[model samples]
Target chain A: MLEIINLHARVGDKQILNGISLQVRVGEVHAIMGPNGSGKSTLAQVLAGHPAYEVTAGQATFQGRDLLDLEPEERARAGLFLAFQYPVEIPGVSNAYFLRAALNEIRKARGQEELDPIDFMDLAEEKLKLVEWGPDILSRAVNAGFSGGEKKRNEILQMAVLEPTLAILDETDSGLDIDALRIVAEGVNRLRRPDNATVVVTHYQRLLNYIVPDFVHVIAAGRIVRSGGRELALELEAKGYEWLTEAVPA
Target chain B: MSRAILQDYQALHPQGAPQAGWLGRLRQRGLDRFQETGYPTSRDEDWRFVDLAPLTGAEFRVGGDSPAVRPEALAPYRYPGTECMLLVFVNGQFVPGLSDLGSVPAGVTVGSLASITARQTELLGHHLGRYAPIESSGFTALNTALIADGLLLHVARDVQVPRPIHALFVTAGDPAGLATHPRNLVVLEPGARASVIESYAGLSEGAYFTNAVTEAIVGDGAVLEYLKIQRESERAFHVGTTHMRHGRDSRGTSHSVSFGAALCRNNLDVVLDGPGVEAQMLGLYMGRDRQEVDNHTSLLHAHPNCSTREVYKGILDGRAHGVFNGKIYVTPIAQKTDAKQTNRALLLSDHARIDTKPQLEIFADDVKCTHGATVGALDQQASFYLKSRGVAGPLARKILTYAFAAEVLDEIPFPAVRESLEAVVMARLNARGE
Candidate 1:
C-alpha cells in the first residue's frame, strides 16, 4: 500500500532523515520504534508533505502515485492521513463545521456526492461513538480548549471519518493516560480494514500492546537497522535501545 | 478648499428665517463651532493617523433632492425576514412613499425627526445634541448644523418595544460631490426595552460624503441594543459618531460593523452615569483595496459599581489600513468599576497595516481595568492543519479569516441580524479570491 526508498529530508540546515526506506503491504500494521531525535516523527511529517521539511533526495509512492509531488491537501485527498502529535487550535470554527468542509472537499475530489448538513451530522454522531465521545465535542471550537486526551481522540475521530487508505499515527499516545491509550488504540483497531494499513511511530512500546503490529522496525540515526516480528518490541522494551545501537555499525 | 466647502453649504441655505427659539440658536451655535474649527488636520492628536485631505479637498454640496430609487435597490439593506419598523431616507430627506410605517404598539413613537420635532419640541429640545458634543469634532458640528431629517424613536416608561426599528439611509443620486448629514435621536424611558439598527448604504459608485450622528439616552433601568452598519460606496467617504448616555442601572450594547467606503471613521462614546450600569461596545471592520477604516471608542465610568466591556477587531487585506483607539476612564468617585477592553487585527497581506492603541485612565483605587491589543497574520500551523484535513490552501485561508471575524459577530444579541451580517461577511471574504 505504501513504499519509501532512501528518503532523505531536512529542515532548513539540519538534516533529519539521512537515508530511510520502508514498505508496507495491504492489511499489515507496521510499527517504527526509535529513541529521541531518531527521525521517527520526521518521516511521518515528510510523508504528509509538511512545508517546513524539504526532501533532499528520495522517492515516496502511495498507491503508485508520487506522494512528494502532490500538495498536502492533494495528498490527503489521495487517501493519505497523518494524525498530528500536537493538534492545532482553530478558534471560532466548530469541529463539525471544519470536518464537514474537509469531507465535502475530499468527496468532490473523488467524484462523489457531497453530504448535506443534516446528513453530515448524522454520520458524525455515529462516528462519535467509536471514540466514546458525546455530541458536545461537535459544537466546540476545533481543539481550542480541549484536553490532551480529547485532542488525540479527536484526531482518531477525524481519521475514522475520512477513512484514509494509509494512516500514519505520529506519537498519538504521547500524553495519553493508560485508559485514554486503550480507548484510542481500540478506536484505531476498529477502523482497520483488509485493504487499509496503519504505520505507528512511537518512542515506547506500551501502545503496541493494545494495537499489536505485524512488523517492528528499529530506526537509529535515520536508518532502519533492525526488523522483526511483534516479539522484537517486547525484547527491546526489556533490554533498551542502547544495546541495539551498540550492535549496529557506525 | 475648506472655506469653499463651507461657503457652498451657506449658499444653499441662505439664513432667511428669523432665528427665534432654542433650536435656531443650537443650529447657529453648531455653525459657529464648525466655522471656528474646520476639518481636523493630521496635526491633531486624535486625527494623527487619518488624513482628511480627501474629504476636505472635495467640493461636496449639502441639501440636494435625491433621485427616485427602485424598491429592488433597497432590498439589500433591509432585514426582510425580521419583523421591524422601517424608515427610509434618500439624500438625508425622509421618503414616506418608500417607508413602511408598521403599526407600532402603544406608548411607542417611531417617525421622522424633522416632522415630529414641532409636535414634541419639549422632548426633542431636551435630548437633541445632548450626548454628542459639537466642540470636539468638526463632523459632529457640521451634522448638527445641517440636521434636517432622521429617525426619532421614543418609548414610554415601562414599555418594551415589540419589534426592532430599522432606519435605512440610502445615498442614491449623482454622487459627484454630494453630501448628507443625518441626525438620529433615540430615547427610552425607565424600565423600557428596545432595539435599533441604523444602516448607511449607497447605490452609485462615485464620490459622496455621509456625516452622521446618533445620540441615544437610556433611562434608569432601561435596556437598549443599538446596531450600526456602514456599507457605503467604494469611492464614498463616511464619518459617523454614536454617543450613548446610560442612566442608573441601565444597560446598553452597541455593535458597529464597517465594510465599505474609501475613507471611514466611526466614533463610539459611551458614558455610564449611574451605578450598576452595564455597557458593551463591539465592533468589526473589514477593509480591502486602498480603503481606510478607523474606529475610536471612549468608555466613561462616572458612577460607582458600573461595568463596561469592549472588543473591536479588524481584518485588512491588499493595501488597506485600519486603526483602533479605545480609551477607558474610571473617575475618582467611581469605585468598584470594572472595565475590560480588547483590540485585535489580522493583516492578510504584507502591505496591509494596522495601528492599535489602548488608553486607560483609572483614578479610582478600587477599580479593575484591563486592556490588550494584538496585530498579526494568520497562524501557519492552523492553516496547515486545515489543509492537511483536505481543505485547499486558498479555502483554508478564507476559513481562518472568517473565523477570526466571527468572534465579534457572535456577540450580537439579535439572531436575524447576526445571521444576515454573518452571511454578508462570509460573502465578502470569499469574494477576496485568495
Candidate 2:
C-alpha cells in the first residue's frame, strides 16, 4: 500500500532525513522507533507533504499514486492521512463543522454525494463512540481548551471518521495517559482491515503492546539501522537506543 | 468648492440666526464649531491614521428629498425571520409609507426625529445633545449642524420593548453627490430596556455621504443592546458616531460591523456615569480593494465598581487600510474597576495595513486594566492542519479568516443579523479568487 525509496529531506539549509527506505503492504502495521532528534518525525512529515519540509531527493507512492508530487490537500484526497503530533487549536470553529467539511471534501473528490447536517451528525456519532468521546466535544471549538488526552482521542476520532487507506500516526502516544493510550489503541485496532495500512512512529515501546505491529524498524541518525519482527520493540524498550546509535554507519 | 457647499448648506436652512430654545442653540453652536474646525486633517492626534482628502475634496450637497423606490428593493437588506419595528429614511427624510410602527408598545415612542411633537420634545431636551456634544469631534459637529431626519426612540420607565427597533437610512441618488446628516436620539427611562439596530445603505450607484450621530441615555438599571451595520455603496462614504451614557447598575453593549463604503469611520463612546455599570464594545471590520475602515472607541469609568470590555478586530486584504484606536479611562472615583481592551488585525496581503493604538488613562489605584494588540498573517500551522484534512487552500484560508472575525461577530445578540453578516463576510472572501 505504501513505498519509499532513498528519501532525503531538509529544513532550510540543514538536512534532516537522509536515504531512508521503507515499504508496507496491505493489512500490515509497522512501527518506526528512534531517539530524540533521530529524524523519525521528519520522515512522517515529509511523506504528508508539509510545505516547510523540503524534499531534497525522494520518491514515495501511495495506492499507485505519486504521493510526493501531490499537494497536502491532494494527498489527503488520495487516502493518505497524517495525525499531527500536536493538533492546532482553532477557535470559533466547531469540531463537528470541521470534520463535516473534511468528510464532504473527500466524498466529493471521490464522486460521492455529500451528507447534510443531520446525516453528518448521525455519522459522527458513531465515530465519537469509537474514540470513547461524547458528542459535547464536537460542539466545542476544535481542540480549543481540550486536554492532552482528549486531543489525542480527537485525532483518532478523525481517523475513524475519514477511514483513510493509509494513516501515519506521529508521536500519538507521547501525551496519552495509560487509559487514553488503551482507548486510542483500541480505536485504531478496531479500524484495521485487510486492505488498509498504518505506520506508527514513536519513541517508546508502550504503544506497541496495545496495537502490536508486524514489523519494527529502529531509526538512528536519519537511517533505519535495523529491521526485525515485533520482538525488536521489546528488546529496544529494555536496552534503549544507546546500542542502536553505535551500530549506525560512521 | 467644499467651502461653497458648506456655505450653501447653512443658507438652505430656515432663514433665522437662531431660535429661542435649547435645540436651536445646539444647532447654532454646532455650526460655529464646524466652521472653526472645518474637516480634521491627518495632523490631528485623533486623525493621524486617517486621510480625509478623498472625502473633503468631493462636493456633496445637503439632501432633503428622495426618489421613489419600490418597497421590495429593501427586502434583501431586511433582517430575516424577525418582525421589527422598521423605520425607513430615504435621503434623510422619513417615508411613512415604507415604515411600520404597529408593534410599538404603549408608552413607547418610535418614529422619525422630524415628527417629534412639542410634547415629546420636552422629554428629550435633557438627553438629546448631552451625550454626543458637537464639540467632541468634527464629524459630530457637521452632523449636528446639518441634521435633517433620523429616529426618535423613547422607552417609558420600567418598560421593556419586546421587539427590536430597526432604523434603516438609505441614501438615494435623487441628486448625485448628495450628503445627509441623520441624528438619532434614544432615551431609555429608569429600569427600561430595549434593543435597537441602525443600518446605513445606499439606494443608487452615485457617490454620496451619510454622516450619522446617535446619542443614547441608559437610565438606572436599564439594559440596552445596540447594533450598527454600515453597508454603503462601494463608491459612497460614511462617518458615524454613537455616544452613550449609562446610569447606576445599567448595562450597555454596542456591536459595530463595517463592510462597505469607499472610506468609513466610526466613533463609539460610552460613559459609566453611575456605580456598578457594565459596558462592552465589540467591532469587526473587513476591507478589500482601496477601502479604508477606522474605528475609535472610548469607555469612561467615572464611578466605582464598574467594568468595561472591548474587542475590535480587522481583516485587511487587497491593499486595504484599517485603524483601531481604543481608550479606557478610569477616573479617581472609579475604584475596583475592571477593564480590558484588545485590538487584533489579520493582514491577508502584504500591502494591507493596520494601525492600532490602545490608550489607558488609569487614575484609580485599586483597579485592573489591561490592553493588548496583535498584527500578523494567518497561522501556518492552522492552515496546514486544515489543508491536510482535504480542504482546498482557498477554502482553508476563508474558514480561518471567518473564524478570526467570528470572535466579534458572535457578540451580536440577534441571530438574523449574525447570519446575514456571516453571509456577507463569506461572499467577500469568495470574491478574492484562489
Candidate 3:
C-alpha cells in the first residue's frame, strides 16, 4: 500500500532522513522503532507532506501515486493520514465542525455525497463510542483546552471518522496514561481491516502490546538497521537501542 | 485644512438663534467647543495613529432635506425575525411614517428625541448630555452642536422592557458631501432591564459624514444590553461615541461591530460609579480594501467591588488598517476590583496593519487586573492543521479567519440579530477571493 525508496529529507540546513527505505503491503501492520533523533517521526512527517520538511532526494508513492508532488491536503484526500505527535490547538473551531468539513472534503474528492450537519452528528455520535468519549468534546474548541489524553483520543476519533487507507501514528502514546493508552489502542485495533494498513511509529514497546504489529523495523541514523517480527520489539524493550547500534556497523 | 473645512461648515450652517433655554445654551456651548477644537490633529495622543485629512478636507453640509428612501431599500438593514420597537432616521431626521412604536410597555417611553414634550423635559434635561462630555472630542462636540433627531428610550423604575429597541439610522442621498449628526439618549431607572440595538447603514455609495453620540444611564440594580452595528457606505466616513454610566449593583454590556465605511472611529467609555457593578465590552471590526477602523475604549472603576471585562478583535485584509486602544482604570476607592482586557488582531495580507495598545492604571493595591494584546498573520500551524484534514488551502485559510471572527460574533445574545450579522460577515469574508 505504501513504498519509500532512499528517501532523503531535510529541514533547513539539517538533513534528518538520510537514505531511508521501506515498503508495506495491504492489510499488514508495520511498526518503525528508533531511539531519540533517529528520524522515526521525521519519516512519518515526510510522508504526510509537512511543509517544513523538503524532500532532497528519493521517492515516496502511495497507492501507485507520487506522494511527494501532492500538497498536504491532497495527500490527505488521497487516503494518507498522519496522527501528529503534538496536536495543534485551534481556539474557535469546534471539533465537530472541523471533522465534518474534513470528512466532507474527503467525500467530495472521492465523488461521494457530503453529509449534512444532522447526518454528520449521527455519525459523530456513533464514532464517539469507539474512543469511549461522550458528545461534550465535539462542542468544545479543537484541542484548545483538552488534556493530553483527550487530544490523543481526539486524534484516534478523527482517524476512525476519516477512515484512511493508510494511517501513520507518530508517538500517539507519549502523553497518555495506561488507561488512555488502552483506549487509544483499542480504538485503532477495532478499525483494522483487510484492505487498510497502519504504520505505528513509537519509541516504547508498551503500545505494541495492545495493537501488535506484524513487522518491526529498528531505524538508526535515518536507516533501518534491523528488521524482524513482533519478537524484535520485545527484544528491544529488554535491551536498549545502544545494543542494536553497537551491533550494526556505522 | 481642518480650519478651512470648519469655516465652510460654520458659514453654511450658522449657530442660529441662541434663545433663553437650557437646550439653547447646551447647543451654544457645543458649538463654541467645536469651533475652539476644530478637529483633532495627528499631534494629539489619542489621534496619533489616525490621519484626519480625509475627514477634514471634505466640506460636509449639515442638515439637508431628507433624501427619498424606498421602503425596499431598508429591508436589508432591518432585523426580520426580531420583534421590537423600530425607529427610522434618514439624514438625521426622524421618519414617523416609516417607524413602528410596536406596543411599548407601560411607563416605557420610546420615540424621537426631537419629539420630546414638556412632560418629559425634566427627565430629558437631567441625562441628555450628562455621560458624554463634548469637551474632549471634536466629533462629539459637533454631534451635540447639531443634535436634531435620534432615538430616545426610557424605562420607569422596576420596569422590564418586553422587547429590544432597534434604532435604524440610514444615510441615503446624492454624493455631494452630506453629513448627519445623531444624538441618542437611553435612561433606565432602578431595577429596570432593557436591550437597545443602534444600527447605522448607508444606502448610497457616497461621500458623507455620520457623527453620532449615544449616552446611556443605568440606574442602581438595572441591567442594560447595548449593541451598535455600523455598516456604512464604502466611501462614507463614520465617527461614533457611546458613553455609559453604571449605578450601584447595575449590569451593562456593549457589543460594537463595524464592517463598512472608508474611515470609522468608535469610542466606547464606561464608568462603574457604584459597588457591585459589572460591565462587559465586546467589539469586532472587519476591514478590507483600504478601509480603516479604529476602536477606543475606556473602563473606569470608581467604586469598590466592581468588575469589568473587555475583548476586541479585528480582521484586516488588503491594505486595510485597524487600531485598538483600551484602558482600564481602578481608582484608590475601588478596592477588590477585577478587570481584564484582551485585544487581538489578524492581518490577512502583506499590507494589512494593526496597532493595538492596552493601558491599565490601578491605584488600589488589592485589585486583580490583566491586559494583553496580540497582532499577527494567520497561524501557520493552525493553517496546516486544517489543511491536513483534507480541507483545501484557500478554504482552510477562510475557515480559520472566520473562526477568529466568530469568537466575538457568537457573543451576541439575540439569535436573529446574531444570525443575520453572522451571514453578513461570512458573505463579506467569502467575497474576498482566495
Residue-pair clashes per candidate, as listed? 0, 0, 0
Better of 1 and 3 by DockQ: 1
* Per-residue alpha-carbon lDDT of candidate 2 for residues B1-434, written as tens digits (9 for 90 to 100): 25755674566455776454766667777778888888888988998898888888788877645778689888767885777899999888899999887766997988998888466768667777788987788888887777656999999999999999999998775546788888999999889999999998876876788889999999999999999999888778899999999999999999999998889999998999999998889999999999999999988999999988898999999989999999899999999999989989999999999998998999999999999999997878788898889987677988899888876787788878887887888788889987
- In terms of lDDT, which candidate is stronger, 1 or 3? 1
Best by DockQ: 2
Q: What docking grade does candidate 2 earn?
A: medium
Sorting all predicted structures by TM-score, with the top scorer first, yields 2, 3, 1
- Candidate whose lDDT is highest: 1
Q: lDDT of each model, Cα atoms only?
A: 0.90, 0.88, 0.89
Candidate order, DockQ descending: 2, 1, 3
Residue pairs in clash, model 1: none
Model 1: residue B41 alpha-carbon error in angstroms:
1.4
What is every candidate's C-alpha DockQ against the true complex, given to 2 decimals? 0.53, 0.57, 0.46
The DockQ for candidate 1, computed on C-alphas, is: 0.53
What is the lDDT for B33 in model 3? 88
Interface RMSD of each: 1.4, 1.4, 1.8
